[model samples]
Target: MAARVWRDPVLWLAFGFGSGLAPVAPGTFGTLPGVVLAALLGLLAPAIGVPLWAVVLLALIVLTPIGIGLCGAASRRLGVHDHGGIVFDEIVGVLIPFLLVPVTPWTLLLAFLWFRLFDVVKPWPIRWLDRHVSGGWGIMVDDLLAGVFALAAVGLSVHFWPG
Candidate 1:
């Protein structure tokens, strides 16, 4: 028989399958892969990177329900609540940083760091939303809010620091 693909938990974890279940910081690790993916995506389309990011956002929106459902079901199977491995939240979170930003290496790095920081810190409404919310939407909402905050930070920093 052919070797099965995606059979390893490490493989799944590396792909953010368990990022959602991360005990202390699910979103933090969960979003890292997205940052890496966005950086790669940025490199492929530096000129229209922001538009490409929009495409990613659209794709994420379409996939959210499916992702949430899968993650929720998986959580039930695993006997866990929001398993850290379910990292669609991270994928969604990282896309925000590239929405309007130029796709230079520096910008990509900045976006990654900004998104990670915001995701981990979970300030203001992100924290509020995270606490109040539940279920699959809840799993992704906090990271989405964190992404918004990160995008704002990057925007302001770009506006003022323009270097």
Candidate 2:
């Protein structure tokens, strides 16, 4: 099973390119790819004559559905519901807060921390959705909501603090 998972392309993606395979803090490790992705998008924006926020948003739009499918399929393949090893959701989740926001080392760190907090803490509706929803949507929605929560928090912080 482990060998099969490692060999499968879909599983490879669902595992956040193996970051999700970490012995501890899989989600944190999974989120690192998102950080790298966000940074790459940020760098690409200027060269493409696009805004950073736009580039990130476009990526999220593209990746969210793919993450959902990859997560769902991987979960089915593993015969587990939202397996911890499937971190595509985490990859997608971390991108939400960075959307429409300035990308800086500080902001990226804050987004990562905030997204992780909301994801792990699973507040209110996020928790509710996580428990009730099923399949790919089930696996993906909670983290998306967590990302929204983090986005709000990050937005507020940036607004009042204005660093």
Candidate 3:
């Protein structure tokens, strides 16, 4: 069956667009689209790419409400809330670890592990923000915090690891 644009943008967003429609684990599927996106973006140059990556995060933070609004409107049009199809949060969250880290296999592996840990754990202010914030921003903030934790660990590992 053909997909309706009214439901999603493109499949590259991953099943996140469709996953949003899923009855369960929409967040998990929504996050996968982001993982792939990070790997692809990691291929870019650190000079331009790092800043660009940060900009993407800024844009995501800035644009989240817009996205949520769109989602909300879509939900109203379709009748739902917190649709699984929206995965921009994952994209932004995943980008945090990759922003400055070297895109090596080992580094990528470590970053991936760390990011997932923080995301799932949701420590400190991340947990607070996740609980207090409402709407799309709330959905996205926790992951961004997770990325921060991952980035810190990756940075420290790079700084402290012995040759």
TM-score sort, best first: 2, 1, 3
- What total of clashing residue pairs does each candidate reach? 13, 0, 3
lDDT per model vs. reference: 0.67, 0.87, 0.60
lDDT at 95, model 3:
62
Off by over 4 Å in 2: 160-163
Cα error of candidate 2 at position 52, Å: 1.8
Better of 2 and 3 by TM-score: 2
* TM-scores for every candidate against the unseen true structure: 0.74, 0.94, 0.65
Best-matching candidate per TM-score: 2
Q: What is the lDDT of residue 163 in candidate 1?
A: 67
What's the CA error at residue 46 for candidate 2, in Å? 1.2
Candidate 3 residue lDDT tens string, 110-159: 66667767766789988898779756556667767887888898878767
Candidate 2 at residue 136, lDDT? Answer: 90
Error of 2 at 80 (Å): 0.2
Residue-wise C-alpha lDDT for candidate 1, range 1-163, written one tens digit per residue: 0111156443353337545445666666677677777776666664654466666666567766765665556555555566556677777677776777766666666777888888777788888887887776777788777778878888888888776
